[model samples]
Target: MNPTEWRTYLVTQESRSAGRETAAVVEAALSGGVDAVQLREKGRPARERYELGRRLRDLTADAGVPLIVNDRIDLAAAVDADGVHLGQSDLPAEIARGRLGDEAIVGVSASTVPEARAAAEAGADYLGVGAVYRTGTKDVPDETNGVGPERVAAIADAVDLPVVGIGGIDAGNAGAVTAAGAAGVAVVSAVTAAADPRAAAAELREVVGDGR
Candidate 1:
């Protein structure tokens, strides 16, 4: 799988330890085979998120992994990140394409077959399909239900693009996610919550057969 096409781990600032920043966890995750990173900071003002995005961009670029901004196209464009991952309420994929142009990788979150199909048709580079498990990050999940193995498999069958199973995925179940047809697993807490973020990332990637 392309680096950006697998094991898509998202690093949320809030998921970090009391004093740790998201950047620290992201750097560690990238070093341990995290193919892509998304900066998903809610409640933070645009400037702060943009600033944070810049640091994350620099960090991921150094590791040769794409950094994606979550839900903030303007901040993403400003930081010149590799891409943006948007929710359904955010700008539609078509409009985002018009704004970011062809080179930028654009992903959309979709919970069902019909949504996934429409997102692909709209030129999304991939689908972020989940809440494969519960997550503290999202206040209101679009489906309010987890994307279990059956749902994952069905969505994978419905969509042609790479699918990253997100929300609450951890090393313990990452293999199951991949087996369910997800191109990768996107996690938030597992790595960041660990005392040794790098080791946590290493262990997690190992579970997904990506230890290197």
Candidate 2:
């Protein structure tokens, strides 16, 4: 899928929620209008992560949505995923692009304008920019405070690629991110941890529409 197509993104399956299976949650989210799904299970064994990536690739493919593997280029290639999302410590976007080739999508995470600009120059197809609100969804570093919606706007302005706001995003604040110039919002707990993942995704999609 093209970067512009990522209007409602879901970063997934962190084993923290009771009775919330990753495959089930992804299926539900897709049904409710999640445009893209990022398989982000960092703590799992490689075999487990690969198996889940394969399952999600099939699920997302069936839904005609892009499935992006987080921080694992090899896993993504193995599963034939649509793309891979890279963090600052991961392989550079240009190198990933070289390995994945022109047809594959590559996204990089950035919290500041310079990072966003550098990612753009490195040939990233899109940018994941935030910590837009205080989030415990991922293990963030001490120096990285939530940059908020204003930072999303700043990063968007600094780069030509599509930008998706991530971290602590939900239906309530998703619209604000979109209004601040993010092409989309990426969420983890908001959808993955919800009692009704499908309903939660739908609600967030609705809120994003209001902002657009």
Among the numbered candidates, top lDDT falls to: 2
- After best superposition, candidate 2 residue 50: deviation in angstroms? 0.8
Give a tens-digit lDDT track for model 1, residues 1-212.
25334665655766455568877777777777777888887888888888888898899888888888888888888999887888888889988888888988899998889889999999999888887887766675556457686787899998778888877788888888888888777777787777777887777777776421
Report the poorest 10 consecutive residues by lDDT, candidate 1.
Answer: 1-10
TM-score of candidate 2 on Cα atoms, chains taken together: 0.97
Name the regions of candidate 2 deviating beyond 4 angstroms: none
User: lDDT by residue for model 2 over 113-146, one digit each (tens)?
Assistant: 9899899889999999888888887788655558
Q: What's every prediction's RMSD, in angstroms? A: 2.2, 1.0
| TM-score of every prediction relative to native | 0.92, 0.97
Q: Could you tell me the lDDT of residue 139 within candidate 1?
A: 72
What's the number of clashes in each of the models? Answer: 0, 0
lDDT of each: 0.79, 0.88
